[model samples]
Target: MYLIPGFLKPSTSFVPFSEKTRSMAARTNKDNKDASGKSDGRPGLGQLAEQHLEDMDACIQNSGLAPDTLAQLKLWQEQQEQTLKAWAKRPGREHTSDADRFGESLQDWERAKATFMAQAAEHPKEDSTARDFFSHSSAKRVNTDTVMAKSLKQQYPNLELVITPARTCNLIAYAQAGLASFETIGESSGKNPESLSWDLYVAPARRLDGAQGGIAERPFFEKYLYKWRGLEFIIYLVDGRDGSQNYPSVINYYILTPTKDKAQLLILEVGRWGADMHGEILVFDGGYWQKSGELFNSIMKASWDDVILEPTMKQAVIDDHLTFFTSRETYTRLKVPWKRGIIYHGPPGNGKTISIKATMHMLYNLKPAVPTLYVRSLSSFSGPEYSTQQIFAKAREFAPCYLVFEDLDSLVTDSVRSYFLNEVDGLKNNDGVFMVGSTNHLDRLDPGISKRPSRFDRKYYFPDPNLKERILYCRYWQSKLSDNKDIEFPNELCNAIAATTDDFSFAYIQEAFVAALLSIAQKSKKPGKSDEAGWTEDLGDGWVGILGGGDADGDLEKLVLWAEIKKQIAILREGMEEKQKVQM
Candidate 1:
């Protein structure tokens, strides 16, 4: 990116349009040289075109980072040159300095790359003093999914192409570590890098693993060259129109390798990009393995202590998972398959989800850090059968993993149930793949899957929390709100709330607590008060008045939280009874 003279940034100075118009008209003296300072006014569009091209050619000579073909390069120059020429003739040119405008528009790297990769398919066979050492290299644009890519391939009939969707696989990063050492020299948007400089724009994205996302520079149209192992390859990474109704941009990549299949081992080593993401888990969804830090973050927050179940049952659930992970040797000695499956069945929202998270967190902390491959569903572009196959394939590849099949009933339907069963039972030996499926309606599952000890070896029931467990859960919320001065949460209130929510599941209890607190925090404007900011944080609907009396045993009923809970519990109980009636 050599800064060509006058190749720069936007000028700070400005001449008003009215004064600019006068200056143009004021120069009516026949020899005033008009606005462009010539006998006849000219916008210098062609001159600017040639000047930008000159800078491009200069960059081509100096920058050694470019593909070894002129096919895309020539096409790029023609496209941007036409744009640069159009901008030069605009009526508002008088307000802008040529240096700043040229700096903004002129990009040299593309032309340099065009000359770099945009060279003769093969150098002269006789005169061979090509110092670059890549004199005879040829490149055919692969990744022929794009129209432009297909067009490039059409031009270079003799060119060889190894096309792949860049997002789907990571050849360069993979080869860098395993296949060959690699170097990324330079990158840019348009084909001619020496032309108008590219501007940067980005949107805020959530932090996935460690670093905050979407804040870094995103070159809309760019190219990267990887000198891997010993081979030189040109990669064109372009952001183009998605051709949809919304007209949003889509990124398409093209890698012009020295030879096809030369990097096969690299692809195999890398596998899928999301197959092994550090600080992330592989979640099979949308017909692909997506790396999910959101799920990982949820797992990080889950602790076994947070699960409100009987102590013995909780410990059994924990030990069951831990024993299975360590029992690979035991299974081998007994001639067992070394694989196990468990089912967690109960009404929704007791502790099924939290228990799974706690298990995932525990597994991740092991010595080797066993990765969890979560199966979201048997849904894929190919079909559910294909998705199920891929799911099991990934499971077998990364065995000793926690394969979670949440909502067992919906995921394994009649259409693909047989295929799923075959994969689970076949002699392929799902060794070290400890599967855990959770369902609220265990009766809906096939007897072949649910009853067979050979398939799902064990079953753990996550029933509704008992009164003692509910008290513990209530105290968990108490510890959270201890520091807040806005609410009062006493130790006895835990028992009172536990006694109040009799038939509620853990999920329903959580809703009761959440709803009660939200109601207390609700703000209201006093009637007949016109003040814009007049608002009071008060629980209405006669709750405070009705529950104002303290319970005979303690003053638990006097607390605002308890008052709100009394109202919420009444509402939840009525709804729960109605739901039960409907179900029956």
Candidate 2:
């Protein structure tokens, strides 16, 4: 009677039985008994008669329904009749649109209420507790120890592993939820419970012991991944914008898994992944999340690209440098040698550094990934206990990395050059330790450094860029400048600059762009000032004028020419002077 849209009257209290209603109820009951075939009749008809009597008694006691109640019942009956009529006149038996049944957004809740009543009329959900037979409860916390043990077994299947359990004196003081697994140790007889070792990986949902522990005790997800394949590689998830914390400091740690059969090391990081040691260990970090998802996705796919060195450069150095790597004759000669080292020497800014980087990129293509060392200072190997041994020690830790010592002359002395020679020659048999050294002062290298046939067997000299190379360099920069149309990149201009800049290093060329930017700033003035534009009239003029137009005396012409020609000469002399002053 308390009606909203789609409201239905409660069947129990709707007892306004006229003569026809009473007759219909009797007939319906009789039909139900017949249809069910009550063979084991246990007062089925009697119960129906009793229920009818109770209904009559209740109606009599309530004085055949009060005027207000009769009015409410009448209204509900009329509403039901109208609803049935509307449903019968619909286009289809089922209402396709929710709007038709629910009337609108507000009536949707009423429709849901009506659904349960409609469903109860046909079929109903079981109310028994036993009906939910297949449900399992989830643990509230993760089980760290179990994860570690599982990782161990998966990494090393046959090795004997024992993990000391955390000490908990009050064993049964309290309890929350528990989970564990067992493994048979002695034999697979299936009946020997005593021979089985019960490995516990516990995650206490509620602290029954009232113990406080830090989250640091938990094993990281990396501890679980045992390098599955025979491949040895380290992957770095580099934050392209920042290098600090981009790589893991501790690069190697052994897993309990039996790894004797598989002995390569690997390192994998989220943003960038790289490996150092052959495959014994792996280190991965993930600090590149700040970048856009698209960029991060590209870095993830970067490992899949072929890392072969540019064929042109590879061909040029193959007879000299590449041969030391691929020569069957050399391999056969030092078939059992433990190490191999090569010296890459050339004029500074020529392309020695670029060649080494390209070679590393190539190695990345050939194999998974190798550890790379970018040596910038000779002091990287000079201290009290700062012996070359320390460098070798680190190299040994990352055993199979590409040990690159840039500017080798700084680290090795004529007196101590033998120490390096001995160290490298010692690793001849260990081809895994590939050593590549680069230096511009090749003539200054100790003769003993190159005395060993196997140590410095392959020497490649990188000369200054020729006209052809200069053209290539110019083309590269021009392509990069294509996105900015405001700047003029004339091929003739680049060729002119390249021709005028003799004995110039690639580094100086790169710096020229920076100088150009400085020139723009020096010339351009702030908008508006004393009387007008803040910019100088010469603003936006490239560095060409600054370097070319020297002075009024013609001394400037000679001076400008000298700046380009004597760039490297001045740099080396300046370095020598600084070194002498420091020693003094």
Candidate 3:
């Protein structure tokens, strides 16, 4: 009891129907009938027609045809589908009534019929010509039907299938098959049409066993594949060890070919680009580099205006370097390498890291935003030299970029001294590359890596803020604390705090403010504190016995009287003294 839908028209060719196609159609009809009783409305006409087309396509593909002929058929089908999609989107004549809609449909039908007649006229009724024309047309229709069916299946695959543009397929292939299976396709010039810097032709590689752990120890295994979703893919697996523990991670890559679904492809590409454009701060760890997520440091929110530094230091270190990075052509004209390096040396808790964050924020917001690559440490890799090469290679790939090497002395150890120096000032050009390295103990670094002019040419000292700078830092905290209406922050409080904290670093001052405000909040909720005077008294003498202070009305003995804060500052000062003693 099979019902053939109206849309399932028999091919207008002399070729006989295959038994396979008939059997497939019969099986589909039986499945549909079993799912729904005859009393129930007939199965969806569209679904039945789609099933018929799928069956016919399967039969055609199984037919013995030359590989080139099949390829030509596939290409023609793709063109027809593209043309139909284009026609569907064309603006039709405006209409106001049902008659107008019917008229538009009639016109479309006429145009399609006329096109078919014109094409048929090209091949006359002569026996040889008619046979060739019929075979070609039948093959073309079958290929079109197969493509549509495949598209439907792809849209709702039974398995999880990831799809990406063909361009990035090699990245995955390289991971799966290793470098041996790929050949460089083409490199991009400055005015290349493609956005990719290079192309790669990757040979297909199947699933391979990837193992992690030392041979002496028990190893864990994972699988890497080179194909997925009827398309090429590269699966890469990374294994690392921490002491006795094994950590493994996998990366998958899929390459999607152009298809009739233009809208779907566009959406996927746009989403990928959007994800990439969002800035990333990468750190090398576990023998590889990985994203640590978005840059969200509180200090980054602070601009140059917020930092309290000597005017001369700011102008020379921050301002001058910013100008040098943005002036690319000027460096070229001077026949100088378009690479600049600066070193910020200071005691712990000064403005080194804060200034770095502010600078990163500024560079990130530039016209063509500069990406920041932060290398936390290279202790995990086999050799610091290898890690250094990897880091610099990445920086080169993302040129016009900023590289931050924190704790330069620790990273460029004695073992990797030569390698670090070479990468920084080697024969290789590092155009549009700006580097900032910070170290608390500048003397610890090797003179070759630290003192080398082309490596870290300019060194800036971040000394403890002077009295005026301290006052400004206090004022900054004052504005911040005023956000809470309950806390009454006075200008005199900031001035007195600034005066008392003579040698305190900006970090210590910030801690003091935080402790004072927290104490005020806690004491204000206590039963004894009713009036504002009680709150003031609680804050003024928060650090009892540390500093002699009782009332809030007169001269304050200490900038921050919180007991815990006093302990923290004492510990910080002790540490700084110990560090200075060691250096001396």
lDDT of each: 0.62, 0.41, 0.52
TM-score of 3: 0.53
Off by over 4 Å in 2: 1-314, 318-330, 333-339, 368-370, 373-387, 390-401, 521-584
TM-score of 1: 0.61
Can you write out model 1's per-residue Cα lDDT over 442-525, one digit (the tens) per residue?
999999999998789999998888899899988777765655545667778888889988778877887777677556656324
Best by lDDT: 1
Candidate 2: tens digits of C-alpha lDDT, residues 75-160: 44445334434533553313233123323422432453354344333333221111111010012324333444454343234443
Q: What is candidate 1's CA lDDT for residue 122?
A: 33
Q: Which stretches of candidate 1 lie over 4 Å from their true place?
A: 1-168, 171-274, 523-554
The best candidate by TM-score is 1
User: Which model, 1 or 3, shows the larger TM-score?
Assistant: 1
RMSD of each: 17.8, 22.1, 19.7
Query: Order of candidates by lDDT, top first?
Result: 1, 3, 2
**Rank order (by TM-score, best first):** 1, 3, 2
